[model samples]
Target: MTMLRDQGIILINKDSEISSAAVVAQVRRLLGMKRVGHCGTLDPFATGVLPVVFGRATAAVPYMSEYDKEYRCRIQLGSSTDTMDREGEIIKQAPENFDASKLEDPSYVEQLLNSFLGEIKQQAPLYSAVKVAGKPLYKYARQGKEVERPWRTVTVHSIKLLGIYHREGFELPCLDVLFSTSKGTYIRSLADSIGSKIGCYAHAAELERTACGPFTLDQTVKTADLFDCFEGLGRDSKAFLSASIDEGIVKATLTAFAGFPTQAVELSDAIKLTHGQEIKVFPDDITLDTVTFTYNNVLLAVAGVNRGLAKVKRVFTDSSAEFLREGSIDEDI
Candidate 1:
């Protein structure tokens, strides 16, 4: 099996009905080397763009989490579910012949959506993975144990109605919406709250993540294609390719940490550094020593200390291979 040499980001176009963890596992096998991690999580019932970080790019996870997310969602009206989604048990139902006009009134929908914008306190649904006393809240709910969950504040940047449609003489109404929100905003809770505002019950029917930070569905690769690429590469070629990729990651880390200009290096030219000097390298930040420019985070190499000297370190070919071989494979997926 060949390991990836460069730290790069993989944009996966995930489909519904499978857990996010399952997708990560499949990618791990395809790549054949560990140290893979994802930026954000999507529920098993939801699907869309999922960005994966490999090798030193894994260090970018925290920074990625802060990125804005966008979702295309559908909400079914006049019926409420225990979990605040269509998959949950129906807990309440409104009277038949519910006037769809109530939902369309600008004052009504605008008021409801406005309440959710900015900072607001919300209670996470019971059927969630939030931990309580070292156990998941959903785990307790399945056992019929009721627990009080405190409301937490979340930010919603914007919410727009993409479209609205209703079936003639149908009991329920549904709305298609687009959401641009900060991290941790629950679409299900938003649905539940909106339903309550209009004297009807509602739950999420469908959700598809369109974007997360800079990653979008258009840039995502299919799992099958990634697998095919993995199978076609020869072992030696794979090793060499993976090593080269790792070196590129080290260089990027150095550039990021040093706050050097992105164009500082010429094509195929390397950054020079000195041995045994503590130099900071940034993989995702201007400050902080998240990653060091050295061999195994030690043993700095001397490239030169002139004004033109970009911190260059001695390349360790064998160590890069060993690092990939011994790197941790136990990822969340």
Candidate 2:
């Protein structure tokens, strides 16, 4: 028989130089599991809080991806890149009429930042991964093929200009910014637009994600540190990787995904949940769009509550028709 898989979310302080897919592959090798999935995609030039879900926790991917994210970015004025970031080719320059002192005034900079707040519409970068006609935009851009990218509406939520700094070799002025934004917002695009709004051209020089919903950089482990732990594992290695792994990454039991608030469900209801049955929900729990059903210290289901009942959206635990029969089930379920 196949053994039960150890599953939970692992937050990695992603290395900016590495692609997100590489991080997932590395984790899969370290734990020897095939079901791992990353909660968000970070560009190779960006790094910080990347949540990797394993086994049963994979059910939480869609729900967790919706959380607002916070990023710390460096915006270099007077220059713009085709990719909207340092990695891309420079394609635009600030108008010569640019006054270096305009950004020196804090109030002017605040106004420029405020313009990004609330709903804003933008065209996705040509080098972006956004798909058009079922093909990634970047793939077309690489071949010198032009595809009309659609304008997407996204919210900045909030923005704060940290400070302006000087880069010795580069001619442009750079601004450090921290902002929380909706899932689809691209910081590089936002940075470039802010520069244009202020009559200066800019591209994202550096980016590091600091937070995503309740998860923060504080809980992440450096990518190198995580892999170094399993450098010598072999037949002689300790059997339990959970006890050996950092942050209980491969632990069977974990805190229910905080992205969706939870509600307690009785034993019978949980058993029925596995079969996708709708169970009665209390009035107070009705307000929750997604409810986690917890019972006996285990997360049994992530449900959608409506019309005074909860319907299973994602079931983590297994249930059998035999168990649903009265007196046929045991407490172990």
Candidate 3:
């Protein structure tokens, strides 16, 4: 059987104004292929690293989203918006006599940011896509219905003030910050929380995710250049990064799924993996909690470790036919 399309991850420097779903649709259309998904949702107004998964890589979305994320955000003090960002209407503002200088105090900023560094409970924004009874909470919000907002524990790895400065204009004072957080942390809510701590409600004035897992925004390719670059890439070719998929894609793909050290599997193990069986490995040599199974550098599955066994957890592709046709199918999957 002939395969359909290349299966790998595409790192995009997603620009603001486009929804994450829109990016997946665009990639699906451009590649003339289906089975596309995004690693995580980046709000329409927030721009930065957005990973678009294609074909088999779509299975890795769960693994990808579990990675720690990094973001640079600007929060404006003295006013809070209904949606927790500037895009929403102002719902509350600081008193006229509220001192903007408190926002510019470095010591005050450090203390406030430190308070959120560990595990803390955060409430999802009311206008977000969080589900309630199978429908997004935003729908209930729009229907003039109030749902009990659930608070979840999200770890903030670190939060640092980028600088203590404010815009000298009619706009409210702002604080810029760089933070690394675990999955499910809402930066907008954190911004609003920061405002409350400062005795004035605040909202996210601007936000951009700089990193998602191992993919950083600085190393991302602009979404606009993908049409030509993607057209030039072939399934067997390593151009996942270049407008042409580059070897960087191959290297990056190797770790995209489990992000664990890989152990080479014997060609004879293919049939075993297909049957959902575990393979034997030297127990002393295996140090990681999990391992990726590869055959001649072709990644096939991520396996769980127990004693000396490697049990297949997720199989990325079916190379059974190719193995039969070529007598040895060793292409990267």
Candidate 4:
């Protein structure tokens, strides 16, 4: 088995009961590449779209995290857990008679969700991967140690109450919620906070990521399907590679040149130049005469305009000098 050192975004429909790292390991083994990494971490109990990037595609991680994420979450009201999820031990329970209408009451639920919108303080659950003193918080939690975690402000773009179910024999109501939030927002904590707001306890029953920015569950491939695709490609085709030296790369390079850490920006202004467009070089302190852009560090294409701005030329999959710097030497030569 040969690994395709290819660089591109891989959409994964991550299954439950497996950690995100586990999925990456599987991909590394099947693809026979060690450069595999994921954009975000999904809990073992949660399932849905998990984007994996291989080789130079790992650079896309920060960019992808900025995109809005969509989730379908189920919350059980009236009971609380240490981890704020069903996986944790129940810490508290409230009376079952707590009005189910509290979730639907415009005066209550709306206020609660609204308060959570924009910027607000949140404390992560103890059984989380958040690091404390160089150790994961869960390590302390398992030993029955309590660590003070400062609250951080996170933004919730939108929260919609999808459905409210009243389960008998349970002290509180259950809810199905659809939410779109900025990165780093914890849905488990949100459920716990909402329950607290309503004078009841709650914990997350289920969570499925529906979408993350441009990537969606609909576009994700199962682990099995990915492995099958890899095997079908065979050895020769496994050397797949792709590159793009678009505005994103340019911006990253410029940031690095300016002595600042590279930051990923959503490139909406990048226009693929066609043939015959004028290549203009501005007289500035920072000028990148030629830049190498890659998907996973695999040279895809280079972009620079000719003297005439009338049309742009795009040489796809061709490693020509036009895309290379003056001093760059071709390894093949």
Q: Any runs in candidate 1 off by more than 4 Å, and if so which?
A: 1-4, 96-98, 104-108, 167-170, 228-333
TM-score order of candidates, best first? 2, 3, 1, 4
Write down the lDDT of every candidate, Cα atoms only.
Answer: 0.64, 0.77, 0.76, 0.62
Per-candidate clash tally: 19, 0, 9, 10
Which window of ten consecutive residues has the lowest lDDT sum in model 3? Answer: 235-244
lDDT of 3 by residue, 18-71 (tens): 899999888777666778788879899999988888877787777787888999
**Per-residue accuracy of model 2 over 199-313 as CA lDDT, tens digit each:** 7789998999999777889878876775666664442223435444543444332343665576766667777887778888666445557877765546768887776678788
Against the true structure, candidate 1 has what lDDT?
Answer: 0.64
Q: What is the TM-score of candidate 1?
A: 0.70
Pairwise TM-score winner, candidates 2 and 4: 2
Model 1 lDDT per residue over 1-333, tens place:
123345556777888888777888876776665877887888788889887776666665665677778998888888889889878998988766667676766566666767777887889789887788888788988999999875788888888876677755546668888888888778888888888777788888888889987667786767776555555665343553354355332123232223212222211121233222333333332432122333333222223233333344333223334533464332221
Badly placed stretches (over 4 Å) of model 2 are 1-5, 235-240, 244-256, 283-288, 320-333
Residue 76 shift from truth in candidate 4, angstroms: 0.8
Model 2, residue pairs in steric clash: none
Tell me model 3's lDDT, rounded to 2 decimals: 0.76
- Residue 99 of model 4 has an lDDT of 65
